[model samples]
Target: VASKSNLSLVGGNFTLQDATLSASSGQINLVSVASKGEIIPERGELGVQTPNISNFTKLGHIEMINSRAETTGSPSGGISIRGDQFWMDNSSIHADNLGDTDGKYIDIQTNESIQIQGKYFGVISNSFGKGDAGHIFINTPYLKIDQGTIDTSTKGEGNGGNIDIKATKIDVIEGGIIASDSYSTGNGGDINITATESLSVTDKRIFLTPEQADFTSTIGSASLDKGNGGRTTINTGQLIMDGAAISSNSHVSGDAGEILINADSIDMINGGTMTATVMSQSSGQGGSVTLNVKEKIYITGFRPGLSFTTTDVFENLQSAIVLITFGTGNAGNVNLLAKELVVDNNASIATATTGLGDAGNLTIEVDNLYVNNGGFISNSSGGIIGGKIFPGFGPAGTLKITANNEIVVSGQGAFSASGLLTNTLVSAPGGNIEIQTNKLTLADGGTISADSLGTGDAGTLDIKANTINLTDGGNITTSSAYAAGGNIAVTTSGLLFLRDGQITTSVGTGVGKGGDITIDNPIFIVMDGGKIKAQADAGHGGNINVKSNQFISSPDSLISASSKLGIDGQVRIDSPDMDMAGFLVILPGGFVEASMQNCNTRDGSSFKVSPRQRTVPFENKN
Candidate 1:
């Protein structure tokens, strides 16, 4: 059916198979109704109004198979579809502006569900001339897209259109995609998705084909030219991503877009990635990723408690949530707020720059945080990729973590330890690390470190906690290969205990001076087989300043500040006055009869012995 003016299709159980509906410069409306009342048409027109829609008792289904509905003109026409259940199989709906005018929009409203199943196109709104593309709005109870796509793009001088979806539940699997792209000088469009119940995106695929085995379900936007990438936002009750991705990346001079997610709980496993990155060879600034989760956020490399049909699917995959720049522009920051955040199974949350740009900061605020099984959080600038030096030019970003309760970092991963790190391989200085928690525990090779490998100075590490515990080779350290070493400062209100742990700063193969270590106001400092050192190779050693009430160390523990060729550093310990009541023993309050023997004619004498009101310091044996 082709129309020069407006067209309307209103009935029950409407089905269009191997058909075409085209409007040259007008609108096409499809309304499915199941009722006995009449649907009053517009005066001298063929379409019904909004008030007549309520006369229907119920809505019917709409099925479009191998069909196409499009409008092509300078100012293209619009398309509206309203029904109970809507299904599109090997079908597409398009609105394109062929000239220098803005395109019209496509609206879909379903009372029941909306399903798009195909290996090809689903819905598209594009601009081919100098005009802007139109927006796409979808409202349904449940939405499922398999091996399909919904896109809005601009290949001309105008901007792309936005996409808004509201549903109770959403599932995008088997290489399904929702995207906006800019191929010209205009900016890309934004995408906003709201799911009241749940949202899941699964699989990774190499291509979008019916015979393609892998699934790469993606929701992303990209800038292929001078325009900037579009923003992506998601709001859901629960979010699950398995081998899927959500990304906004730049491929040219345009900047990447931001990503915002709000959920009650989020789970990302099996190479699932959430990233905002400036692509290689591009010159744009990377965007940021912000997550606000009410309950928890869990990220892991491999799927737990699940059997995979193809083990190679996740053989070399690693799940990550990152913001990185591999271009000439600066990277963006990552901010997360949640009740609990867990990173496990070789997963990572990081920000890095492998090019000329500077890396961005990473900030996490949670009630409880756990990084175990080789999971790590880091920010670095310049690195050796593929065994070749990148020599990135700028400084690395800072890392800040604040936990309201406790933080536990334990266990090692396949290649790296479970910890937090900041490093720089270029001439720029490394970033700093700051952590604040009520209680902190680092065990089983867990570490917190900052280092520099080039001429730049290493960054500092500052920690403030109520109590700190480090055992089983856990460490807090800093080092510099050719520059001045970084410092470590720890402040605790309670005891600072270390068993087989270490706190050190050193300079290796460099003429730079070593860094300092400071421990302040601990009730007691106890170290069993632990070491605290500030050493240098050719420069002066660093200093160690400690202030505690009582300091105790095992026979094997050592604290030293020594230089190999230059002058040694100083070690200062200041012990304040403390109450001695807890360590003193008082005399008894009763009197006792005592007997004494004198060498005077073998006679025995007896007397009354009274106790004194005095106390004596007790000695520790162990």
Candidate 2:
């Protein structure tokens, strides 16, 4: 089982315990060398005598047990180990290529430490037929794997190989698996990890083996049918995960890969999961998850099994750290570039779609963005069951958040773009929630939503801030039922504050209509029980614009445009300075206007103000 062999063993210390080394069908080399000292000069000495090379404390330590090293068939050539220190507990290293060729390559170099522990340790390069599958290079300063398995697999049509690791320090505990798998049509492989200082994936407590009790620690890739899924790159300075999981998946029609992470600091606690998926009988598409952290990123949540005197508050929650995607094509993008981003307790960053494509796009570039307790950043799409004779649509995706300085959403945190309701069909719209911030804060029951129920339409909600704060029961919404209803734009340069917060656009019983609500501020304040709304039940109702220099409202605050069966909307206030003692309303054809005037006082004296108008008409129910 050898072809073109090269074996060298000149040692001072080299050990192989239960050995079985086969260089099957290839160019083989099994080498171990550490011995140098040949100098005898005393007869030609005269100002030239140099001979001293002796430093051996059992030089170049390497130990292998229950061993098996293999390269079996076709263009094969692999197996290399050069060491200062390397220990394999229950070893099995294979470079397998049986049918279509190409498979065999493994280079491991160690200067200080590398330890592979038990449970039948394996390092494999596999391919069933049609070529491809090989390459696994590791360079280490310190690397440890407790329950090991490093694999590259392919079932038939080839392709699947490439696992490069360079370490300063790396640890994979528990059931440890670093994998690349492609089952049928091939293609799936590529995992590069470079750790300059620290990288850890944990789980593994005291080995009480109940099948290792839910052992985690995994770095993966899998493509099942038409095959096409790879790419998982991590460049770390510090990355820590507790229950560990990093995945890339595609189940049927392929396409689902890409996960790039560059870290200076990243911490994912207990139920850690970072995934990119395209399943539900995939049609392709659904990948891309990028995280570039220069300073900090912490996604927390972890409760082993509820203790500390727990009385089962839903089993004491906390076990979340997820960046997810699910699909039928489309449902994959999540890019977070952070300086400081913290997502607490029920952590989540999601992109979802149930079937017909669309639903992916969540970008967060942070200087400082914190989402508290019930955290969530979502983009959703899925609904349409009965009804739709010829309606084909796919919309629901978009959430862009940029915080250059500060953005905080407290407690029941949520930022969503949703479309999932299908009674009379025509479903497909709901996406768009853009936020640009310098300072924006939403307290307590924080929520930002864009929703469309069926007949398509309901999206826009844009916020640009210099300073904007919504207190207590914070809420910002865009709603629709049989269509149209979505548009709420607020641009603030200095101050806009809403106390018991609420900003809405709504429509319910069919025929569409009910959207507009715009506020541009220099200084606008609504007190105690703040509210700004545009509502309609059967149709038309929208329009409430306020441009402020100074506009303050207090008695219980309220500015509304309402309709019960049809038309009624429009409430405009352009302020120079106004203190509305409380409510402003419009009921039928709408119209509640405010314009105050006369001011010239720096000694010329002319101060007068009085302007408030209203118009209303009922009965318009068609």
Candidate 3:
């Protein structure tokens, strides 16, 4: 049925089987109205305020199959289907505007559940003229979309309308999409979803044919041309995404949109991704991605306890990735705030720049952070694989991590912000890495480094924690090849222990000087074949200064500042008491020298030791 005025179907149950409904400038309302003493009220007129429903209409499954409902005009009013339960299979419902006016809206409200199935099922609000598209509001207790799409798009000069959905539980599976895209020079619309209980988007067909799972079930926004993309925000109690994505991107010369998520807990596994990126051909700046969780955020690369026989590990990596590049524009930043953040099994949070603009920063604020088993958090430039050289132009951005409780990096996990070396002629300097936590631990070949292999100087390492422990071949270094080495400054309150670990810097054989190492703590111990050296092969050696209450070195642990050909650097230790098991050199409150036999001396080869008390001075020659 087609009508110019409003259409009202007041009944206990409504079922349209292979039927069509259309209203060209008016709304179609399917609701139940109350009657008083057998005096029935007349249906409300178009463009007039209608009486609200006296009570919620209870219907036995209002099903629409193979039906089409559309409203088309200059300023159209859409369809409103309110029932206890709703289902649409192989159907289409649209509210489109053809003239230069804003389109109409579509509202579907149900008290129990709403399900849409079939491959050709769609619910759209589109605009073809120079006006904005209409909005789509869905309110239900449970919503499930299987192989269906809910879209709001515009092809004119006006912006697209927003999509707002609120449900207790939502599941979007099997190539389902809820998108807001703009194809013209207009900004895209926003997508906002709030699930009170839980929200999940996945593809279960991946178990049968793993290659078909390469696609993603997405809820996103996009801009095709010079219009900026719109934002996507999701607030849920718990979110589980497997083989799905929530993103916002720009393809042309427009800025990408932001993606913000707030949840109690989030677990993304099996190649699920959440990103905000600018496409390769666009010159627009990348958008930001912010995630705030109350409990924890777990992101892993592969499926847990799954033994795959395929050779493609790239298809199973869950990525919380963000990018702002492919053109001459700077990339966007990523900020994650949670109580505990765990990124394991090669899951990564990276920000890089391949164009002329600089890379974006990555900041994480958490109570505890665990990055292990090939997990990485880095900000790098010169995007060449296998450490190959490229022509670098832009400078890399910094990485700042702040943890309230503890931070752990183990099992080949790396936290690096190193400058990539271009072809030996020109190179950008490495970005700085600043980490502040209560306790920092690195073990099992874990590394935290900032090196410059190019002509630019390396960035410094500034760490402030309560206690720092590095063992089992873990290292914290800052070095440069042609430029001067970066400095390392550590300030801990309790203890700084290094067992078989290294905290050192070396200068190149050129004119660059080595960087200094300064440590200020209460107790500093380096034992079991640990070395703290600032050696310069041909350049001038750097200084090593330690100010602690008690300094102990045992079992072949060497702390040296020596030069091979240039001047020998100075080693200054100012503590109340010092203990070296093999050799004892005591100097009290005055400058003293401890000589070593068969050592080549340069212009200045002196070891200064100043204690707190005024006691006897003894120099030992070994």
lDDT of each: 0.85, 0.71, 0.73
Model 2, span 262-376: residue lDDT tens? 9899888765667676666677776788999899988767535421110011222233322233445776788889889877766666665655777677888989888776766
Per-candidate TM equals 0.87, 0.44, 0.81
Pitting candidate 1 against candidate 3, the one with the higher lDDT is 1
By lDDT, highest first, what's the ranking?
Answer: 1, 3, 2
Candidate 1 TM-score to native: 0.87
After superposition, candidate 1 runs with Cα above 4 Å error: 1-4, 38-52, 204-215, 303-315, 384-390, 576-622
Best by lDDT: 1
lDDT of 3: 0.73
Ordered from best to worst TM-score, the candidate numbers read: 1, 3, 2
